[model samples]
Target: MRPRSCFVRSSLLLCSTLVFSGTVARAEAPAGPQAPPAPQAEPAVEPPSAPQVEPAPSAPAIAEPAQPAPVPAAPPATPPLGPTRPKIDVYVTAYGELQFAYFNYGLDQNRAGGAQRDSRIEFDTNRFVIEVKGGLPDYGLEAEVEVEFEHGGTGSAMELEYEEFGEFDQELDKGGEILVEEMFLSKKLGANAALAVGRFYVAVGTLSEFSRPTDYLGTNRDEAETSIIPNTWDEMGVRLRYKFPWGLRLTGQLVNGLDSTGFSSQLWSAGGHQRRFEVQRATDMALVVRADVTHFDGFTFGVSAYHGDTTRNRPKADLVKSCEEANPREVAPCGYVSAPLTLLDAHLSVRKGPWSAKALVMYGHLKNAELVSQRNARLSNLLGVIRTPVSDNALAVWGELGYDIASVVGLSDSHHLFPFVRYDYADTQFKPREELYDNPRFRRSVYTVGLSYNLMNVAFAKLDFGHRRLGSSAFRPENTLRFATGFNY
Candidate 1:
């Protein structure tokens, strides 16, 4: 009876659980189509949100993975390099002149009786020069080179030599020259100063300072300065230059001195320039100082001085004084005699409006000139020189004034016609020692009048007439007519 009761209870519980599960399944199943529900209004006050929950899956779908961030591209490759050149500035320029002249005087005026009545005509390519200027601005360095072709460069002439009584021979004469007028390197010390070294013009006269054809008014260079000193006198040396804000410039130089063996009455020290040998002698030295003031527009004034010892520059060192008690064992040139040369000059230049003028006064002195003359007289006949007694002093003065008639005659500025007048006086033997005679033939005065035509200072033509008078009235006066044409570029 008990076992039957337990079995009936178990069967009833199982039946109840199966009926509950069936009911749940029926509630969760999808319903048939029904009418839409109405929308409800949102709440005025928001309530706190529940924790996030994942949505239940309805169907399978395909998806792609996230992509990585992009990277930037690299720059283009660089090219290989080549050699780098230095930065330098360079310039080149040239100028030249041709001249024709007629003179009523002998070519050899220093003859015994002086030139009488010989007329002549001449044509010359006076000079041609090329200039090169270079600069390394980064280093404050500059260089200049000037090459001059004079009288058509170089030439040779056949000459008959008869110095010895019974011997006659033919010789070759050096007639012209090809010269290096200037070659120098300079370093700028500061904004207002510079230093230079090498061969350059000596700063003792106006010619050396202003050598361009357009710088002066005459057809030829100043005769006065040329008679006493080397024309465009150049020497190997060192130079220092300084400038002041007030338009003043100062220059100083140390250079080789002139050779005294070539000194003579006719040319004074003009021939002392060292050009006879392959190398120049610098046993003696010279000092030069120059000052120039360009305070005014188109006007300038200056002064310069030079001093040098000359005796030691001779070829053989022969100009020595004999010792009182000479010994055979003593070497040559026991004691050298001192002969110094001193030169001074003042110059002025003005070019205001239609007027232009230039003036200069130069004087030079020689110490122990008597001894130099005596020794020069005894030189070998082969040494070409005047063989005349040199004076102790020399003087030179010259002035030129010109008016640009182009404006006066209503011509354009591009065309210039200048009517100029010039006066020159030079005395190679101004004063002499008691033992020497001062030849009056060495003194000269010249008056010149000319017309110069130029096209903007680049090309020019000149015609001039001059009358030259000797110191003594008994000597015949000389006259000259000259024509010149040149380019300055």
Candidate 2:
């Protein structure tokens, strides 16, 4: 640009010199001829023009490219870290079972479906369950909910017990109970620890794992537990659990306890479940502690115990009832008798390759059974002379072993058939109350043989035979044939 300016100035000076020369020539009287103006193109040229055309601004535009590339990179780097999240998950699983059963003999005069009763062969729906689980990753919280349908009927109603003395009846509902068997909230304490609250299955025996129909090999949960203890015993509670590095776990729970008023000669503490009425009494609380060792492959051994005050858990009526017509011998129904219950159980489970086996034995003791039985006898029947005897101690034991036959037959891994055998013994009246004679009818044992099959990882089927005996050979034995089918996830 400087060179152009210099050339223009030099040209102007030279043009002035030429004009003077021409003027001099003209003035000197040479022929008057003005040189025609040379053709001019600079009229259209404006080298210094609008602001947008400045070359200095274009230099900054090139520099802007350097900063903006990193500007976009900045947003991208943050997005990869800021917006990412793990998915909060919810899962659903379900299981159900159907059974066809035939009893060879009647359990008692009042029972149905036997040679001496109403029907021998019958079809029934045992259990159906749908489970939902949810997790909140950011909050370290989780929840589980279980919905169950039993007996396969539907209604806008539910059946319940009419809580009254001398009443052995269920407020009848012609509909199935859609029960919320389990619902709980849990928090992760660490990698191998957790704390939970709400109504959930109690950790006492194999029931925690074998509560689902498909988890056990036999046609039903072994008879011993179902007879002496609460089957799938779930209670309102808080639980703490920790897992050790060496395949050992320890757990403790504090929960509401059973009602001694419902504990009887027949059902023992099993009837103490407070489902007959709303609002269980928490006046009597139980503490349960369990320890399990799984250090050996395919083996788990555990022991659990509980202690609670059962008398305080009863209905208020039982505490103050003084029926002169019923109990002339005693003034009142063992007025607030201090009956505490203690339960201890040991369990073992094994699963290695194609073999599955489990064993559990539970013993329960009640303090002041003489008093509890005396109160229950009059409560159940005030006018009757004879009364059902209650026991001071109860015992239950069961064991089962199974083997998978698919491998032996060269079948695919998805196919399975396990032939198993099991033995169960339960005596709610293991130790009869003092001053009452023990009935040989109280202690019972069952021997079962079954074949269980699986299909497509979804469905299961079972065929089994059961022989049940009461007391010694002096009592007649009961026999049963059963078939069961179900699907579980």
lDDT of each: 0.82, 0.76
lDDT for model 1, please: 0.82
* Candidate 1 Cα deviation (angstroms), residue 143: 1.2
Q: Once model 1 is optimally superposed onto the true structure by TM-score, how far is the C-alpha of residue 462 displaced, in angstroms?
A: 0.6
TM-scores of the models, in the order given: 0.79, 0.76
lDDT for each residue of candidate 2 in 1-489, tens digit (9 for 90 to 100): 755564464445445444543433442212222322211323322333422344554666766867744334334343464666766879999999999998877656323321253348978887799999999878788999998887797424212245653344434565666677799999989888999999887788889767776677888888898786677888898999999999999999999998776676667887787665556788889999999998999999999998888877765446543444566565354465678888899999998899989999999998888878777776544221224556889999999999999889888999888999999999988866658677666688899999989875589999999988777666666888999998989
**True-vs-predicted CA distance for residue 252, candidate 1, Å:** 0.1
Q: How well does model 2 score by local distance difference test?
A: 0.76
**Top-TM-score structure, candidate number:** 1
lDDT tens string, model 1, 261-337?
A: 88988789998988765567888999999999988999989999999999988866578888777666754537788
